[model samples]
Target: MTSWRLSRNSVSELRPVLSYPFEAAPEHGELCEVAPGVYWLRMPLPLALDHINLYLLEDEDGWWIIDSGIALGPTEEIWEQIFANQLGDKPVKAVVATHWHPDHTGMAGWLCDRWQVPFYCTQGEYLTGLVYTRATSEHFGWTNEQHQIRAGRGQVGADAARKSMGGAGHITRSLPTSYRRLEEGTRLTINGQRWRVVVGSGHSPEHACLYGESLNVLISGDQVIPRITSNISVSGIEPEGNPLREWLQSHERFLQVLPDDVLVLPAHNLPFYGLHHRLRYLIEHHEDHLLALEEACSDIAQTAVELLPVLFKRELSDSQIGLALGECIAHLNYLYHRGQLERSVDDEGRYRYLAVDDTLPMRLRKRQHQADTELPVQV
Candidate 1:
């Protein structure tokens, strides 16, 4: 579930509106101290986005590693280097995976086995990872091919997506069979400081973000990023899921609970300080997209593939098409679930969406307006 657009142009306009607090990023395989006893590490990804950021927190006896990198030769090599050079004499006491995505938790089992420590993450994420890893097997019937076909992707597109998913190595060979579940409000004492877990969904099942009130740091695992919006897609498992709505609500919750000045350490981008600004930006960004999509479907019903050009103006590569399609369906499902649009299955087993009317109902319009003008919650 590497949810990212291959083309940066899709988010170019939003990028200039936000600012990065840190100019320097950690070199690959190296750690940069973002806060006292907390270090940031960047691992190389083989995709267009190119990198994922992992964090290490100094604990009482050892270190707590957050968001392990993908289980690839290069990524494992980087971890080896960090163990030899960066960790000094301290051993990794625990491996904390923010979610089930390979880029985030691919090395959880490997790290836990190496350190003989327990794996920490939400129960949903850990269980989903098991499902995804098993899905790579030949005997697994629910492949990405079927998922694409169910999402209105043509046969060619479905085949291409299947090939890409198989090649991505998303499901690590070694997945942890056991884990320690971290739920909302669960706090862990690391190095005399408390880090509380805050769970959010839409991007992944039970995505856990750690908030340290004393340090005013939020380890936002793919939940909130400064530049790019996290991928909120309608997967085959939950085809009718309105993840877009869940994603926005999660931001609202963040605004309610988090202080504005907390430095956010995201999974993909550089560390930044504008938590509320970024959250509001993401909310408005999707709202604008939903408006455009609603208008596009006013006359003719459209498939998720047909609406790609409406949402993403730029051309997409074969690999990006699947992700873009999933994202497009997410927005369509949001509108469909909200009564803004109507959905119907065609003769070919494809779902088409059409706007219900030219104008939204009073309640939906008011909701949209509130989202447009809503101010960030003051801490």
Candidate 2:
């Protein structure tokens, strides 16, 4: 058996009402059939998250790959093994990435190069991936420092974080210079089953989830996980972005559009059922966190760094500072935009957030009315 190791902080003790149809996840370099032609593949990640689940959808002439793992020697070795033993001697038709995150698109270029196939992803994801893939330390150092300083960390903290912030070379390896675009509602028939592209946001720009109505399966890439919530962070690319709001809004959109009976194949954790149950849980989870963060900001003005304790209870390492700060800012920006909090700069050149009004927490009730106007369309 291959070791599936995750840091203690990454594991969640709370299991929601979602149902897991599969008894266990596929071991490394192995595939488990999830649907008629969809198979599950897990790859190791040298991070707190530990692993990411990729997918293979079979077609008449070839197979479609979803989400290549991070660019690591072990990951490549596992792919080589799978290519030698699995795939039934069929060629890869295309490499589809749900988003631009390194763990999802890290090996995409290499895979496409190997199979001589086109890389499929949304325009937003593709462009964003290119920016990150070619980003130098200087590109991030100045902007990231400014971002951190505005988040309430002083120069000292900013310098420390800048030094710890590794370049993109550590995560993403390469990307195809040219590629195919996956637009919203785009349908592709594979093995007589139609899969529609369901675009989502907040976690990443234009994240795509594939929903197959006939198969009753959804390939949700970090959009909806069964146990842990996806990281909705404000990055240096968009410092004042209210991604938490967008994240919640996306969940609302999903609840309105997607069916409850589909089996969700997420990028993390085990594949599960009870889509509606999990979606509602995810919305409530963030709402609860927002309320907690709101309450934390009521008494005294708090910096994003200071408010990190309210969201994450564990001790954070230096390498995790960037993500932690980004998530902290996301929560602050959500409340700030919702009129529940006010932001100001402190004497130390750091941002501080404080509650302003007794307004009710923002609700998604109004979003339902607008859902139909933006229904999925044919590509």
Candidate 3:
């Protein structure tokens, strides 16, 4: 029997409640009750950038914040509003991050230092978050991103990429503070409520998923969402990925253990019920992406960059295109690693891909049974 790898859930059982769309002038972030003691603190990431969700857990001693938002002007202003207005005297015991993403772990160090509280996360998450983010500072701050935009055709994306990078400097202004590592199945108590950790993969390495059994709440932390599928993008580093496979496996992990009625407190979308259904929908989304990829490449195998618009469509705006391209690379890398596609370099030093048999794509090969029913389209 084959051992199943970890993945992201792809079901659509729970849809976004449309709390606040991150528009040009987005709706400001606020604290909302997801479960009994679990609260989501929305943080602004301005103008087509990050819209992060920081969590707070009310406990007997004080509060335990999970995932501090980016440490920029807007994010800090909102954080001050939240910390001063709501959690004034409450002692922030610990801050837990789900992963190393800037949006999730951005202000962890600042918060921990401010409150004299210990930061908590997986060892992989804490260390990687610190090192990788710092190392990529130049890349994000528009220093070298021009190279990211397909070499010669890189003008249109340069500005946007620079803005994105500078935003990183704004968000990730704090690090070097200490953090405590939390492992999978780790249990803790908050204000009398008991919670366990459930880690997910593909989207980010060693991503943590918190489960509050008594309240039936899961602090999903980007592990799952309602409307839009969480991005499983492959970046400059770690070019090899089996994201489709990893995402599929992550969903099964959630389904096999998590109950249907558990309320999901996603890091992005509005919290809701139906974890099982959401898992299935997320799974189906990747499957569909793979199928779409298969169809797009049936005629001729294309490099991940060339095939992105075909998979996601060219209807998206400039920023959306970059994101779509990233996800495209992730899926394509996944397929490549699974041995379905062989990669080569042209004389011009450009990367190209070709399927094994040149007849049918791997996704289409065993897809007759499940592929019969149309899967939901990814936005």
TM-score of each: 0.88, 0.89, 0.80
Mind giving the per-residue lDDT tens digits that candidate 3 earns over 229-336? 788876545545566567778889889889988777787756667677678767866766665565555556566667866566447776576567778877767767
| RMSD list, candidates in order | 5.7, 8.9, 6.5
Q: What tens-digit string does per-residue lDDT give for candidate 1 at 228-304?
A: 77888876656677888889898899899999889899999789888888887788678767866776676688888
| TM-score head-to-head 2 vs 3, winner | 2
Q: Tens-digit lDDT track for model 2 on 196-272? A: 99988999989999999899999999999877788889877778798888788888999988999899999999998
Candidate achieving higher lDDT, 2 or 3:
2
Model 1: which ten-residue window has the lowest total lDDT? 1-10
Instruction: Order candidates by TM-score, high to low.
Output: 2, 1, 3
Which runs in model 2 stand beyond 4 Å of their true positions?
Answer: 1-15, 164-166, 360-379
Q: What is the C-alpha lDDT of each candidate?
A: 0.79, 0.82, 0.68
Best prediction by TM-score: 2
lDDT of 1: 0.79
